[model samples]
Target: MHERMIIAGFGGQGVIMAGKLLCIAAMNENKYVSHIPSYGAEMRGGTANCSVVISDKEIGSPTVPKPTIAVVMNTPSLTKFEPMVKPGGLLIYNSSLIDQKPKRTDITVVDVKANDISEAEGSTRAANMAAIGKVLALKPEIASLESVIKALDVAISARNRKHNDINIKVLKAAFAQK
Candidate 1:
């Protein structure tokens, strides 16, 4: 089955990096994938969004009008993309940044306290990693948990070890909560 995912948040939150990592992992799995990132004024606080499409067939267009999954790190991003996700899709919310809940009943919503999970793991910036973990766990196209950790270990640089580890923990914890 085809899956479309969107990760949106403020700049420096690794929103784009997370999307790229998914693309990397999907490609590693030998699946057809495409990652499109939004830039410019939206990169700040306005709205930074990145889309990842994974499927068995050739992806005709990267732009998605209806995503199968969405990871929103802020309220505005959540509100912006909430309606775009299709019925029976998935939406992972960074509860640390958003206070409101999704009102729709069609999609499965997973609220992750990603920031706290990252903080407890010893880094504040790793929240994005944590969110990524949750997304990977819930998405079938993503690698297994062990594979994901292994990928991250090899993918993360020496300087980013701390961030990488914490995010993996966040992903594990989020999965457990589900």
Candidate 2:
């Protein structure tokens, strides 16, 4: 059950952190996983993305040239990674931020209003968790909700641990919404 995923968004949206959470969850579930992060020069508004590979067997490489799933949180990311999704793959975009829909018909496309939902929850940053939740819901075999919670504990730092509840709330909300 190999799954290659690309999580992308502006630098401040926690794209890399989301990939790290996925990798941590996969590892906790005893699955082989890899995470590779790439970001532009500027920190806040620059492009940020990560390639994650999860599988039952050993992974050969971390690079994901064509991902099986693409989660884009911004319009630029949607424009950039939409074509990178492999044929028959899945594309999940934050509809609140990306105005344009995916043009591809071969692959499955899901519009997740992550930003709006997160904002409604009082934490706009939780949109990343919402997007991750959407992915886990669509592919239950990838990781369990318990694993995700545990990963959140490990991924977040001591200073930022206070927001864990909000993050979990947003995750469950997104999962339940679909």
Candidate 3:
């Protein structure tokens, strides 16, 4: 299946990493995937967004104007992307970071306490994985959990084993919870 998704948040929120994980998973699944990151001055404390397109056929444009799903890890992300998602699309928001409810009725909004969940899981920085897990839940076509683990191992390396494990656990837990 073909799907275009946007994962957005602030810098240091692991927004880019989350998008990378999705791209890697899609590659492992042998799907055509393209990842484009949106960068601006607010990267550090500002906005972070990635556009990913997965399709059975060749992708025509790398930029995503209307995504089928938008994973928002912060209030700004939620606010910026919530209105741009296609009607009947899926929106996954880090409820812990965004308290305001999404007003869009055309799309189904799934709000989860991603940050709090990851913090409870002992990886406060893994809120991105929490978001990824939620997205993977809605679309089971993602790479297997095993693939995600391997990718994480490469992403984090052995230097930070404890952090890696915690994030992995968070991702798995999110999968089940989702």
Candidate 4:
């Protein structure tokens, strides 16, 4: 099995962190994984994205030209990566940030209120986790939920560990809603 995914958003939205968590989770499952990140110079509100590939077999490259799944957290990201999702792939976007619906009809589109959910959970920063949870629910074969929880323990920094509980809450809530 193979899954090539792209997670895009403005910097400081945790787009790169989300990709890292996905890769860590895939690694936890003993899958071959690759993560490549790109970002603008600014610390926040600048373009940021990452390409992640998880496969049961050997991975030839880290870059993904056409992703099977695209998770966009902002309008700019949606506009940029929406067209890159393969037909019959999944496009998950943050509805709280994107005002319009995706134009494609061949691929499945999911609008997740990630920011709102994270806000309701008392931490808006965890919107990325909510988005990832939605993807996990939609594609259970990608990685196990337990693996994600474990990845958080390793991927999150020491200063941010306090928010782990709420992040887990947001993830569980999204998974339950799915």
What TM-score would each prediction reach against the true structure?
Answer: 0.88, 0.95, 0.91, 0.95
Error of 4 at 30 (Å): 0.6
Q: Give the winner by lDDT: 1 or 3.
A: 3
Q: Look at candidate 1 and tell me the lDDT of residue 156.
A: 67
Evaluated at residue 45, the lDDT of candidate 1 is 60
Q: The CA-based lDDT of model 4 is what?
A: 0.90
| C-alpha lDDT of residue 130 in model 4 | 91
lDDT of 1 by residue, 1-178 (tens): 5888889987778888777777777677778889999877655666788988988888988987798999999888998899999999999999998999889898999988888888877777877777877876777556556656666765666788766656777667766666
The window of 10 residues in a row where model 2 has the poorest summed lDDT is 38-47
TM-score of 1: 0.88
Clashing pairs in 4: none
Residue by residue across 1-178, what tens digits does model 4's lDDT show?
8999999998789999999998999898999999988745532454688999999999998888899999999998898888989999999999988899999999999999999999999997899999999999998888988999999999999999889999999998888775
CA RMSD for every model? 2.1, 1.9, 2.0, 2.0
Task: Give the Cα lDDT of each candidate.
Answer: 0.80, 0.89, 0.82, 0.90
